[model samples]
Target: SDRKFKEILSKSIHDGHKIYEWLDTDEKLKLTRQLAHSVKLIYYLKLQQQLWQDYYDLGIKDGVWAPRISK
Candidate 1:
């Protein structure tokens, strides 16, 4: 499943508007959710890092941003 998901992402990235041609409705929904989660994670991390750096530049010593994942 992981390999297949990777292939879908790769092809979609290169082919641009071809995801509908490659996946059915259910598959499209699943892939969209996965992609959205990934994008949110990346945005959160980047924003956290920027905020931490801002605090550090302002001379705040305890501005450490540590990420912990819990299932």
Candidate 2:
């Protein structure tokens, strides 16, 4: 599952135009759920705590930047 998630994420980032064009709303939701589940698993593993912390920080930053970016 982790491997599949990473593969999708990598494809999204590396070939975003093609990926986004092909991905539908349901597929996007499924991917989001998969990513959230993966994050929970990583938290349980206790090996990616700092990475999770950084992701949280970035989420905060993105929220702050979102309004400006949307314009």
Candidate 3:
């Protein structure tokens, strides 16, 4: 799954470069907004993956633990 995710991320980034080379100014503005949203989505996915990893490392077998963020 991680490999697949990496492949998709790589392809998306490559496609972004291609788009940037061709799109006009107006389109680039719209793309900038979309890219900002995508960054947030990526952040959320990484946070989720880290939470799952922490749970696994803690030997949380039962689906009863609530994940909390550490400052």
Clashing pairs in 1: none
Winner of 1 and 2 under lDDT: 1
Listed in order, each prediction's TM-score against the native is: 0.50, 0.32, 0.45
| Candidate 1 lDDT tens digits, 1-71 | 64466465656587745655556567675877687689989999999999977876665445454445699
**Each model's RMSD to truth, in Å?**
10.3, 16.3, 10.2
Off by over 4 Å in 2: 1-24, 47-71
Error of 1 at 4 (Å): 27
**Residue-level error in angstroms, candidate 2, position 14:** 25
Query: Tens digits of per-residue lDDT for model 3 on 1-71?
Result: 33343344446675654543444366564666577579989999999999988888676557566556699
The number of the candidate with the highest TM-score is 1
TM-score of 2: 0.32
lDDT (tens digit, per residue) of candidate 2 on 6-64:
45665657565554444446667587767768988987778677777777789788884
Quick one: ranking by lDDT, best first?
A: 1, 2, 3
Report lDDT (CA) for all predictions.
0.68, 0.64, 0.63
